[model samples]
Each structure stands twice: as C-alpha cells, then as structure tokens.
Target: MPDQVTPPPSMHWIVPFAASLSEPCQHALPRLADAKALPNLRRLLGQLQEVARIEGDEYALSMPHERVLAASMGWPDVDGQLPWAAWWAAQDGVKLTADAHWGLLSPGHWLMGRDHLTLLDPATLALSETESRALFEAVRDLFESDGWALIWGASQRWYASHPSLQGLPTASLDRVIGRNPDVWLTDHPQARTLRRLQSEVQMLLYQHPINDTREQAGLATVNSFWLSGCGPVPACTATPAHIQLVNALRAPMLADDMPAWLDAWAQVDNTVLKQALQAVDAGKAIALTLCGERHAVTLATAPAPGLGGRMWQSVKRLTSSRSGPDPVALLNSL
Candidate 1:
C-alpha cells in the first residue's frame, strides 16, 4: 500500500506553489533530520523548545509545524500562515509532508484517539479541545459572512487559474480551490514568466527616478507611475510639467484618480520644461515652510550646498573639466 493517501479524502492541503525543493534544501535535509526518535510528548516538546531557543522568533508555537520544520532545518524564519493540507497533517499528528507519520503536541498533552500533530496557532496551542472548537466555529462564521473562500492549490499557477482568464471557461469553486497541479502546470509556462516579469517591472518602478520627485512635490504617497507611451492616467490631468515635477521629486502618482486641481493644470513644453524642472529639483530641498508675518506657506526651496548638492557640484565640475566626454551631455543623451 502507498504510505500516504491523496488529499481531500486525507484532509491534507498542499501549498499554492509546489515547486520542488532546491538542491541546497534537499542536501540540507538529513541535517534537518526528522524528530522520529521523540517517543512521547515530553521529548517532542523539548525538541521544539530547543528549536525556538536557537532560532528565536523563527519557530513559534502558533505557526504550522511545516514552517517550523523549515526553520528547524535552518531555512530563514517564515510567516506562521500555511495552506490547508499542511495544516491538516499537523492537526492529525502526521508529518507535515505526506511522507512522514510522526506528530508533535505539548509535553504530556497527547490524547489516545487523536494522534495527529496539532500544531497550534498562537491562541490555541495550550487550549482545550472545546476552546479550539469554539474558536474555529467563530472564525468559520466570520469567513462565511465575509464570503471568504478557503483556497487550496498545489502551486501558485493553479491558484491564479482559479480566477477568470481571457476567454477560457471559468473554473468551478472546487476546481478553483482544488490542488490541480497536473492540469495547469502543464500549460502555464507563461504564468511563471509573467510572475518573473511582474517582479522585475516592480523593481524598476520602485527604483525609478520619479519616486524622489513625488516626495519633494509635497505629495504623501507615490502610488503609481504613468509613463508617457503607456496610457493616460484617469482623472489625473497632470500636465507634462506636473509629471516631470513629480518624477524629479521621486514621487509616484497612482495612474488612477486625479483631484480637481490637477485636472485643471496646463500643458508644458517638453524640452524646456524638462530642463527647468531638473535644474529646480536636482538635490534641492522643496519642502521648506516660509513665513511672512501672519501668513505661512509651503515653499519649494532650492538645493543648498548640503551633502547631495555637494555631490552634484562635484560631479558637475568633473564633467565640465573632462575633454573626452561631457557627462551632462552623456546623461541627457538618454
């Protein structure tokens, strides 16, 4: 007979992404050797406490044992949240993976019929069965009221396929939440590429020159960036001047809604506007407050000979003196 039964029938929930263990992770396994020798509650609890002491907050009593399992093996501390299959196995006193059978509970807290590992959440590790049941029921009610569905997937690609796509038939609830790796993973090379591309794009956006501009523009948060060729930002009638100003200050604008004032702004001359904006913004302090008798107003201050300005000046001097290439010309060449 197979050592482990399949999921659902077995009450095991797998993660959304079931990527294979990295070679390094695989190599480190025997080092992470299972706690199979722990014969009873006292030994198991002692092992867990030792793990916690070594790793500090990495291994918490509340998180799923799988995460604890990873931490125990020297994986960096991860969040306590886990998918259902892993959670269930831990609950049943089974190993977190389908392969293992050992489970852990607090020392001397084991029950005869309930032999599965009951990895407790922060609030429940020390609780009685009745208390845990009450808490689960209350949370279940809240989930139903909020229309939150409990999702399961063997990989992130399968999880994404749960939602609607261009024209394909929408998956049913069970299909949406089920761990169907065989179906989706076979056809979704694009999904993995898409995730990678999205990550790279976000990194560039975060490091974009416009972020500092928005901060200096007196804007609180730079939610998004609206590149010229991409598309127009809704409600934000930001003139070219406004975009340049925001970019120079390193502030982002959500390409979403624009307030009334931004809508009424005027267009700007791209070349001249870019130059003026750069001159006004480069290493400049723009958030200073100027007071005149009873009236106080926010003023855009010019860059002082502070650290950033000093750096800018040094660069300017170096570029001006260099004969082989004009640094400013090279910069604007972009």
Candidate 2:
C-alpha cells in the first residue's frame, strides 16, 4: 500500500499550499479577507504560539513543507533536499544496497510554452496501473543499462536507487507544479546524466502507443520523467506518527482554481479547525503548520497555564507595545 502521511494527534497539522504564487489565489484568499470569515481558524491562530518559521524564495528548489518534513525526520540539509525516495523505499521495505542513494522518478508531461518548457501536474497524467507498468517495462532497460536499480512503487511513484543520487539536488514535484524545471535545476555536474536520461524517456515516449492513445483522447501525453528527492539514505530519527498533515487545499491550489481553494478552505476551517480548537479545549498539545510555496510557519499551543500566565503574557505584549503578527498579513505574503 502507498504510505499515507498521517502524523499522530499530538497533531501537528501540516497544511500544504495554504498560500499560492498565482495572482488569482493571492488576491482571493485570507489576504484582504476579514478574519471573521474563518472564525475557527482565526481563534486557533490566536491561541497558538508562533514557534518556528522556515522561510525561502517562492522559486526555491523545494517547497517549504519538504523542509519541515526533513527537519521533523531529524535529517541534515533540512533546506528541502530531502532523500525522499530513500526514505519512501525504506517505508516500503525496499533493501538499500551498500553505499546506495535513491530518488523518485515520476513519469509525466512537459508542455512546451512559447519559450520554456513547463511541467504539468503529474495528477493530470491519469496513468492507470497497467499502463504505468507497461511504460515502466519499456523504460526500465534504459535505466538498468545506465547501472541503476529501478523499482515500481505505484502508478505515479517509481523509485531508482544508485550511488549517483548522492548530492544531486532536484526540485520537489510540489515545487515544479506548472513551472519551468530549468530555474530550479541543480548546477551539480551529475544533473547532466539525469537530463540525458530524461531526454531518452521523452524520445521513447514520443512514439509510444500510450501517447497516441492519450492524444486521441485529448489528454496530456506522458513525455518525460522528473527526478527529485535525491540523496543517499541517511540515519534519521522517525517522524512522530502523531503529527497530522492536512492537505485540503493542495489540489485546488495546484490547479490554480481559486474558487475551489476557497471552498476547500471553508471545509477545512469548519472541520479541521473546529476539531483543532476542540483538541485545544481538551488540553492536547496540537499545532498548525501552514505551508506556502516559500515558507512554513508552525503555530503551537502557547505554554500559558492559567489566568496569571495569561495576564503576564498580556503585560509583556503591552510593554513591548507590539501586537502579534497580523494573521491576514502573514497569509497574504505567504
């Protein structure tokens, strides 16, 4: 079975795509919007301590959540170059050979814009299990001939283990959504080999029957594969299973559908945030980590214990003469 990331109810809700780089989403979001609109979310934000902030450029090679995952897993290079395949393969009980490194190779479409090529969302590929297996068989020999061990994890997830993966930095699939790969592509010399491999896959796929069928059906054809989550498997602490990850806005945000995003956010605000506030009332230590293209901010339960503690906090706030960060401003910028 595919590993679904569900952390425990000590519940650190990692909300991905909480903000967007698209103008439509940027303009139509919690930004400029009143706090009263999302009461539960607003209350939760006010209640939690703004503990950690991981900031980056929106154009960074990895999404902010990737950095969060790496940190939570206690790995080095927490800046987003996560050894995703190695870690995922480990979860799937795939053996790691001596001195091996691993990476995820996702087969998908690359649409040529007027000037640069943009990678489409992999979900749009709609590859079925049988079709994915067939495509894998066709492409496996190429990777094997290049001295790599490629294994199938799922229709969308293919794993490749090789020593060459060490120190090769590629963008997270989340980071590359609807964007050109060129900007985030690493300057590492080893990247040339992956580029060559990608070109080979494109050429092979161009004449494949799957593309012909997809084209006839008015669907995007699978043209190439993306290499990401590159690194050698490292000794790392386990991610606490109690931390929950809420991905309600991921799909809508990635598709650039602001309306759908608003709807989903409403649902999340009603369901997830409502339950989160309830959890707080029950005195469970929970948190909300809202992740955007460039940053992840973790809002944890403040350590105030009683009325006296609360009064002290208020006094400090007054002495500092600084209000807490405006939730509106933070979400808007994110």
Candidate of highest TM-score: 2
| Per-model TM-score on C-alpha atoms | 0.16, 0.88
Candidate 1, 107-214: lDDT as tens digits: 111111343321111221233354334323333333334332222221110111111121222111111111221232213332343234223433433443443443
Total clashing pairs for each candidate: 22, 6
Question: For candidate 1, which ten residues in a row score worst on lDDT?
Answer: 224-233
Q: Report how far off residue 41 is in candidate 2 (Å).
A: 0.8
Best lDDT among the predictions, by candidate number: 2
Over 4 Å off, model 2 = 1-9, 30-32, 78-80, 90-98, 236-238, 310-326
Full-model lDDT, candidate 2: 0.78
User: Total clashes, candidate 2?
Assistant: 6
Across 21-94, the per-residue lDDT of candidate 2 in tens digits comes to 68888678754356456667766766677778988988777788878878888877544368887776677666
For model 2, what is the alpha-carbon lDDT of residue 176?
81
